[model samples]
Target: MNVEYKRKFTAVVTALALVGIGVVLLGRDRVNAAGSGSITGTVKLTGTPPHMRGIDMSKDPYCVKQHENNPAKMENVVVSSDGGLQNVVLYISEGLSAGEVSAVPSEEPTVDQHNCMYSPHVVAMDVSQKFKVTTSDQTTHNIHPLPAPGSGNIGWNKSQPPGAPPIETNWKAPEAISVKCNIHPWMHGWQVVVKGPYAVTDEKGNFTIKNIPPGSYTVTAWQEEYGTQTAKVTVAAGQPGKADFTFKAK
Candidate 1:
């Protein structure tokens, strides 16, 4: 082959080899970057359940059938520090690098007050993100949030006449916020204002948060009625770790 032609062919081969090596290095990086762990466990209530207060079964026609003559009395509905669960807010306390709070935030979460009860009594949302507190009853409802110290409560006293638009509004804060409806007196709820992603346990009292970078972390669990429980967890790359918290009734 001509000398120039041979030189061109060598250059092409060298370039292709470099690209292939680059691709291989990138694949290795992706493998190492798969260093993520998970947190999972059952949050159980460990004490005698509290009594149902604040709801009137006689007033709202829907209460008796929907909640079945007092949901506050159900075992699954109780918030116990010792009995093992309710309003469980399990989340990473800190240390892992985190992104800024979403600008404009995601869709607002819904907290509904109906028939003198806060549906999904325990709520959680990212800090500074917008969320909606709504009412379905025709009565006057006042939303009172017990915000963190130095953080004033966000209260809304909007009359919700029957068949009227829901008494709704948005709240954005950086700490766990307790909520209540003063009109019903028995209606109560909680908002766990986490700094980042978090989840509340389901009826089975189980929760799992995935894709956390390997490291030591403080996992906190909070219930409106049962108060809070916390545990320390160490995560290794590609492993699932457990941190269970149990609380007793006072």
Candidate 2:
């Protein structure tokens, strides 16, 4: 073969080799993301569930009208028929690497006030991750978040009129902040801030925190009324770990 052709062939071979290496590295990254373990469990409540007080919205005709036929009740303690608890925040409280702890989500989480109630009732978000608070009700509403002292999060109260733009905000520290609507005193919710992945229990009390790196972790479950319960969990690559918790009745 000609020297010129030989040189071109060698260059093409080197380029293909580089491309193959890039592909392999990309695959490894994809595998690392997809192969990470998860934490899944059920949060249950022991003993009889507390009675949820029904809210008297007659003071506000708008709120009353919203729940005209169906009355609204406090959600401090919501337990399923089988003793499963709902709206519990489950997250890795400790043992996460710096990379996992600092992995703030790009998309902002949202809390919406609709029909005189906070949608989802509970939200779990990463610290420093911005989140949105919006009102969808026709009536004016106030967003008041009371973060615990020393939690590094400042408490704020703001009013959001109907159709107002969403309020974007973030928590500087990790804490479970109690959120309420000052206008509608009965409206209540929680914002659970954490440094790593977290999950909220569903109606059936099931929660799953995904993409957790393999390690032993201190998993905690926090409830608005029951406080917090914790358990130790060990996660392995491509496998799920269990950390069930049971809160006792008061």
Clashing pairs in 2: none
Q: Per-residue lDDT for 1-250 in model 1, tens only?
A: 6999999999999999999999999888655643446788888755555665444555545554556754644222554343446568887776556552233347677777766677777778776667776667655566777666666446445555455564444556556666766655566677767766577887667888665657777888877656667788887766777888776656
Candidate 2 wrong stretches, greater than 4 Å: 1-35
In the range 42-140, model 2's lDDT, one tens digit per residue, is: 999998898998999877898888898888988888889998899998888888888878888787889899789998789889999999998888899
In terms of lDDT, model 2 sits at 0.88
TM-score for each of the candidates = 0.72, 0.87
Error of 1 at 40 (Å): 1.2
lDDT value, residue 166 of candidate 1: 49
Off-target runs (Cα >4 Å) in candidate 1 are: 1-37, 51-84, 98-107, 138-140, 146-149, 152-154, 163-172
